[model samples]
Target: MVRERSSHWNQKCRCLLLGLTVILILGAVVVFAAVILAGRRDPPAELPQWKGRGSTANLEEIILGRCFIYTRIVNPELRKDCLKIWETFKNAFVSKNPCNITEQDYQPLMELAAHPIQCNKTLLWSKTNELAHKYTKVQGNLLTLEDTLLGYMADGLTWCGSPSSSETNYQSCPHWRECANNPVSIYWKMASKTFAEAVCGVVHVMLNGSINHAFGNSSIFGSVEVHHLNPKKVHLMKIWVMHNIGEQPSDSCSGSSIKELKSIIEGKNITFSCEDDHRAVQLIQCVGQPEEPACRVCRTEF
Candidate 1:
């Protein structure tokens, strides 16, 4: 009897231990699941708030200020009726639907803002805004559209109109992609077209080589400017493909897109040539990144 009791006690103890082990495992699993759930519930990083309307604040003052500055300081010799220019620019879209604006609507403004571009001094760029502008400032011999009257006045400002009222829509403006012909987009297209048509002699095109499709067909330079270029006036088209100092180039002069550009220029009976990492531009790029190995090498070579 004693032996049987002892054996029964041992069996009970074993069963109890097994039950405790399962309970501990279940408790661990629950804890682990809670931690995972807490991590998932954490909030995400903040992003830029969407401005339902893309109009720049104080649009008139900004534009008028830029106009006066351009005329009085940038190009003192050229006299422009800043007030008349503003009126004509405002009339283009003040009472019309923002999406319905066309390049023709801006013709009067363009005519008023028109000025002569020096031959071989025009520098057009695609996907290289910052660097191109910097180059213009650094070199002092090249001029982009933004350096001119029309482009300077409206470089960073956004404006649109409401069809229901004869006033600028400060509350909301259509984005460039939201409509086929937003006012801002149409203005740039017309400006680019005009700028291209005025360019003569050796026209320089600066292109970014770090990104794919650096010479895309849809860009203003590719779509509007290239089409508007007057072969009769332009003597040679020089393409400079520039890349970031330390990064490998994603595209080059021999890239498919550039080849397409070359073919198009050839078809137009214009002289075309391309150079990779034009020394002047590369040196300018190196200015901001002197510590980079590639930039260091560039400094040594140049």
Candidate 2:
């Protein structure tokens, strides 16, 4: 009997050890999984680069630059006024031109007014250093509107008379100020695309990388290189200027396909000197613009 009791005790001890071993294994597995996930999280900063080149098929950029609004839009009432202006102008068609009112959908003016608000046009450009540090493309969106007109103008819902790309202007009945028959119009789809956010220095988000829509040609693009920060996100380093007429695209847009802007940087670095410093350069892609050169600055390998 004593021997039998001894055997039972041995069996119970073995089961306890086995349970502890299973628990330890599960704990080790959970710890490993957590480390791998943490390693894959997104980085908190963005890198910089210049923009150049573009495609003709996509609409041309209308108002290029930042829209600087000087006001306190934090208040709920202020926000309401901003939205009201947009709602009114978005439907601001003369009601005479059914096509302009119905088909265009104020897309033209909305495209033009997508910049951050500034008192004057010059403020939108190169800052004199004092304001440059305060204003950034990422933080620009947070600045609120002091006026209603700008919000109306930028909103996709607001209409800007009739925007037409065709040289042929349509004559309308009795004149009514600037409103006469046709408002100085822009071809919304033909002009340029406005982004969810406005960028600085150069208009980078308007490139093929961010929008991803196919242009007149069957070609499609993925990412534009600004830096190695985010491989999945588009960097505004490469730009497409767009050819409105006889101008041919810059030589960079020629043969082969590009998945990202890396293809351009991969080539031999073209080195040059500037006012007080030496620089390296290379051509990426050219979409063609009226006069702007397609080349810009980028990172180079030594």
Candidate 3:
């Protein structure tokens, strides 16, 4: 009788062990499924369709702020009616077709914001926008279009309007290549022409020597500014061909493109001069590249 009871107890223990094992396995499977499901979350939501390639947000505030700041701090010697300037600027394209904008539309704004550019201080650039501006900032004697009131207010901003609406279109604007007469392109062309026309005495042009055809005919400097330059006012045109510290020189004073520029200027009866890797510009290029061999050599030579 004792043996039978003991066997019965052992059978019960075995059954209990089996039940626990099954329960444990089920729990593990449930946890694994939960972990997998949690890890497989849905992707992030997409942006709104209209939130792309549009006029800058708070465009008026930004432009007006720049205008006030420029008038108050940058060149206090000159006075500007910031409100009037803003109104004129808005009227140019606020109710017009973005693609139909022309240089003439911005004439009033340009004239209203126009300021005297010191003689021999104009700096024109092609394919060297950043470097040219940096050079101007560092040298302080040269001034690019962006340094003036008109260019300063609109630089690096996108703007457009619809013919049907009297408000700025913050949804989308035509790209420069999308249309021959996009609002932004026309404004820059007009600004460039005005700036170039005002240049007198010695004028400086900065070109990228690391790119082919640095002086591209389609560029603002080539097509608009160059055409507007007055031979009688501009006594000399100095070209600086700048190359990156480590880049192979792609174009220089003697390059075909430079030759073409020279021919054009000479034909126009303007004194033309070209220098390869001008020291002042090259020094500016070497600012953050002290380890470069070219920079080291340039440092020693200077």
Name the regions of candidate 2 deviating beyond 4 angstroms: 1-80, 101-200, 205-237, 240-302
Residues 11-58 of candidate 3 have per-residue lDDT tens digits of 999999999999999999999999999889876533222323889999
> Please, what is the whole-model Cα lDDT of each candidate in the order they appear?
0.90, 0.30, 0.89
Candidate 1: segments with Cα more than 4 A from true spot: 1-52, 297-302
Ranked by lDDT, top first: 1, 3, 2
Q: TM-score for all predictions?
A: 0.80, 0.22, 0.81
lDDT of 2 by residue, 1-302 (tens): 99999999999999999999999999999999999999999874322111211111111121111121322332222322334333343344433342333325555445433444322111111111222223322234422221223432333322222232211122332132333223222222211223212322222211221122212222111221122122222222333322212334322223132222335333313111111000110111222322344344356989
Task: Give the alpha carbon lDDT tens digit for every residue of 223-268 in model 1.
Answer: 9999899999997999999998889889999999999999999899
Clashing pairs in 3: none
By descending TM-score, how would the candidates be arranged? 3, 1, 2
